[model samples]
Target: AHGVARPAAPLSTFLVGFAAARNGGTAADIEQACATATGLALEWAKTHPTETR
Candidate 1:
């Protein structure tokens, strides 16, 4: 969230944990959730480079 929604960083983390739990609370599930969220964030940052707040 460096150049994006900094305030949303914590919310994003919570969502990732929730998703991982729903998918089966395992290390692999957590890893997958983090990867998926990271990919989406990167894509969003790339496409919406000027987004703020």
Candidate 2:
């Protein structure tokens, strides 16, 4: 997991949820998107720390 700041983590998840909704995301879509985003976050954290929380 990216080291997202505790205070901002849930708020940021809303953005991700909105994105999933905008894309007509079903449960599968949400899962896939979340996985992708999480993977990217972990990768970015290795260098630039993309998480706010």
Write down the lDDT of every candidate, Cα atoms only: 0.91, 0.74
Write one digit per residue (lDDT tens) for candidate 2, span 27-49. Answer: 97788778877887777678974
Residue pairs that clash (backbone atoms under 3 angstroms), model 1: none
Candidate 1 weakest ten by summed lDDT: 44-53
**Deviating ranges (above 4 Å) for candidate 2:** 49-53
Backbone clash tally (model 1): 0
The residue pairs that clash in candidate 2, if any, are: 4-53, 5-52, 5-53
Error of 2 at 26 (Å): 0.5
What would the per-residue lDDT of candidate 1 be over residues 1-53, giving only the tens digit for each residue?
A: 68666799889999999999999989999999999999998898788777444
**lDDT accuracy of residue 15 in candidate 1:** 99
lDDT value, residue 22 of candidate 2:
83
Candidate 1, after superposition: displacement of residue 44 in Å? Answer: 0.3
Model 1 lDDT, residue 30, Cα: 99
